[model samples]
Target: MHPFARSLVTFAAATAAAIALHAGEAAARTPAKPTIAFVHGAFADASGFGEVTSRLQDRGYTVVSPANPLRGPASDAAYVASALQPVKGPIVLVAHSYGGAVATPAAKLVGNVKALVYLNALALDAGESNFGIIERFPNRFGEALRTRPFPLPDGTEGTDFFVDPARFREFFAADVPARAVARMASAQRAVSLSAVQEPAGEPTWKTIPSWYLIGRQDEVISPAAQRFMAKRAGSRTVEINSSHASYISQPDRVTELILRAAR
Candidate 1:
């Protein structure tokens, strides 16, 4: 081969090898991301996580937002665990509001949930019921709440709890856009009263590394209660100036915290 041509070929080979080596190093440094599973709370569904889910999906995350059975804590957790069982890999389980009460137990059942990310979510301790913990802190949540009785499958009666749509914006999402809050209120799902009274099982936050995002302006769940729970569970906590609708109003912050737990 001509001397110049031979030199050019040698340079090309070196460049190719260098590029391959860099790619290998990059791959080695980046670990495979865990699946992110979300559990929605009462008065809402999985679609409430639209912005956060979209952001995570855009970043190549495998996301699962399962419908939480609003019957009660134990039942809800069992359903969530079963839904995520088919996902093969580690999971960073995230929950909001009442869903937090469900995620802890579900994570324990799923067994591969590496971290718990709470977004203004409940972090119930063993033997603590939803209403039990909330009563520990003073809040105006009760003012917006409404309840009704429904006939159960066994022919007995069950009570369903809901936020009065007229007052939803004031207590649930004061900071969110009025239009958005209206939509949320209209589509809200009711949680059985038994759910609030049922005691939580052993908490998964006890064993897993957990992250908590507390909303200072949350009228539903008091920020003081959030701090108390996060501190007790030894979670890495960040407080934001948001309402109970923190995930909806501050999707970026919410997603950042989840990513931190995920990484």
Candidate 2:
């Protein structure tokens, strides 16, 4: 081989080797993406998070959509905290509606929750009850809710709150497509009366960062109430023309807000 050609080959090999080493080092230094744990609110199940969860997963994020036991605030929070125990790294707890009441305390319990993302969710303060907050805001939501009696563990009857099937689409997901709204209305899960009535514990938002996506057209939890909580929690807030079921109706915007929190 000619002398100049040999030198040029050696220089190119060295440059390529250096670039590879830098790339390897950068990859090693990058932290793993946080696990996104979604907590669905009352009168709903984990399936509510399907679109957002799938979007996060597609971007290489580990996601957990745990079924929120619609019991009471304390117990539901405990259940969510326990469900997240197996997640190895940092967590971003995303809650909707009543699930926010659960995630507010559950985030603190998880110890590794780096952010709380509330999607038209209830971000209650210590000693503040969901109904207490709702009544203060005054919406047509009360007229849509109905209660059914069931036996509790203590052999006493307890109430499970549900949206009247006829009024479900109007109150919860008016912006969502008709077919999807029908599925949601038929598959609605009942949240206990205890869940809304129970007072929230110390909110995790004060300590951890928070992002809130407020639905301006929300009837279940009035936009007024949502704005009040977002201001009180000092959350990074975004608003959309949506109903309470923002995840189902406005998945792109909802997913974007969550991605911001995760980042």
Candidate 3:
């Protein structure tokens, strides 16, 4: 064979081998789509994650948005645990607002949880409740809504706590349209005060690799408090310019974060 021909043949063989190795590595590194369990925050049910869940399902992910009892963490955690029991694969637990509190104990109940995605969610330390965490910070929303009487039998009070159609647009769902916000507020459930006051026993974020979505314009939970919680949890933070109901305001960004964790 000619020397030039031999050199060309050698180069071709080397390139083929490199391509084969790269393909193998790529196949090996590809991760399965994790079962994503979404937990909604105070005053909201599973429906709050409708848009986000639909987006995730479109991408071929197994999505579970469980309806929390709006009870204290212990009871709500039990509900979350039961919901997770049917999942047959790895899980990426995603929580928003008060749902973050529920995710703590629920994540512990599930053995296959791979990561946590918090959407302006609570990140409680040991023996800390949502109220306890906020107590340390300045609470404009709490102060404003403190005077408004809770219509529910159980005296829980907050702007986003009841989900009035008029107030929802102004406080939680300002970015969303009137009809959607009206529907959301009409269907909203009242979270128990016990849930807010009850402290988390063991925070799951402490052990899991966590990611946080910070709602920069959040009024319900202070953006400052969100930052503090995210930092303390050692989370990877992404900011969205939205109100307390950021998942509704920016479903795409929220879905993207969840998908990142699923991978």
Candidate 4:
């Protein structure tokens, strides 16, 4: 090729490369979509959020349903905080039941958490505990819980609480499909009694913009109790006529509330 022609080709290629580099830089500078980190309540694992997470992911949102240790609020919060460390950009933390307690303290540790979404979950204040609050506003389903002694890591005995499988459907997921409820019961994780009884640290909902979804038919956490906490936290509240497992039975609505918080 002629020298002039070769020079022109080289210049064109260089210009293209620079433009590509600039575009990459600009994309990097542009903020990414905030992640939705979900916390499952006691007697549940991240798998329980399959539908909700999938729907959120399909909508171009990154969703994480971390395992709640169900050890206690402090330790559970620490575990959740560690999970949040690797996540960049804004976060919309969603929790159900006891997970609310974990998310509350965990959010306090992560500045990137911009919103809190509670699905029939606990939203306790400083010096308050899941069990403590529940005690004040007792749910009839509380009578369905079955407890057994379990050995703790330190060799001491601690109580493990689970909704009796026979009553799980009636009290926890009455509105969910029978097949799914059966599966849920079989895979249920027993929450340590000590965990629910421990008091939480400062409540993050006090400062975070929060959204609460009340399951009006929730037997686990009575709707009345849910309202009390939502009102206390000044959360934007929505009521759904569902069970304690509204996120399972009404995942679309739950996901919608989560997206709203992400916004």
Best by TM-score: 2
Q: Write the per-residue lDDT of candidate 2 for residues 1-263, one digit (tens) a residue.
A: 99999999999999999999999999889988999999999888999889888888899998898888899989998999999999998999999999999999998888999999999999999899999998899988889999899998899999998999899989999998888888898999999888889988888899999999999999999999999999999999999999999998888898899889888
lDDT of 4: 0.90
TM-score against native, each model: 0.90, 0.91, 0.82, 0.90
Every model: Cα RMSD to truth: 2.9, 2.9, 6.9, 2.4
Report the lDDT tens digits of candidate 4 across residue range 17-116: 9999999999998778899999999888889899999999999999887788888988999999998899988999999999999999999887889999
Lowest-sum lDDT 10-residue window in model 3: 143-152
How would you encode candidate 1's per-residue C-alpha lDDT over 141-255 as one tens digit per residue? 8989999999999999999999999999999999999999999999999999899999998898988999999999999989999999999999999999999999999999999
Worst 10 residues of 1 by lDDT: 132-141
What C-alpha lDDT values do all the predictions have? 0.93, 0.92, 0.83, 0.90
Q: 173 in model 1: Cα distance from truth in Å?
A: 0.5
Q: Residue-pair clashes per candidate, as listed?
A: 0, 0, 0, 1
- Among these predictions, the greatest lDDT belongs to 1
Over 4 Å off, model 3: 1-31, 143-165
The TM-score, computed over Cα atoms with residue i paired to residue i, of candidate 3 is 0.82
lDDT of 3 by residue, 165-260 (tens): 556667776788888888888787777666788878877888888999999888777888999999999998899899888888799999998878
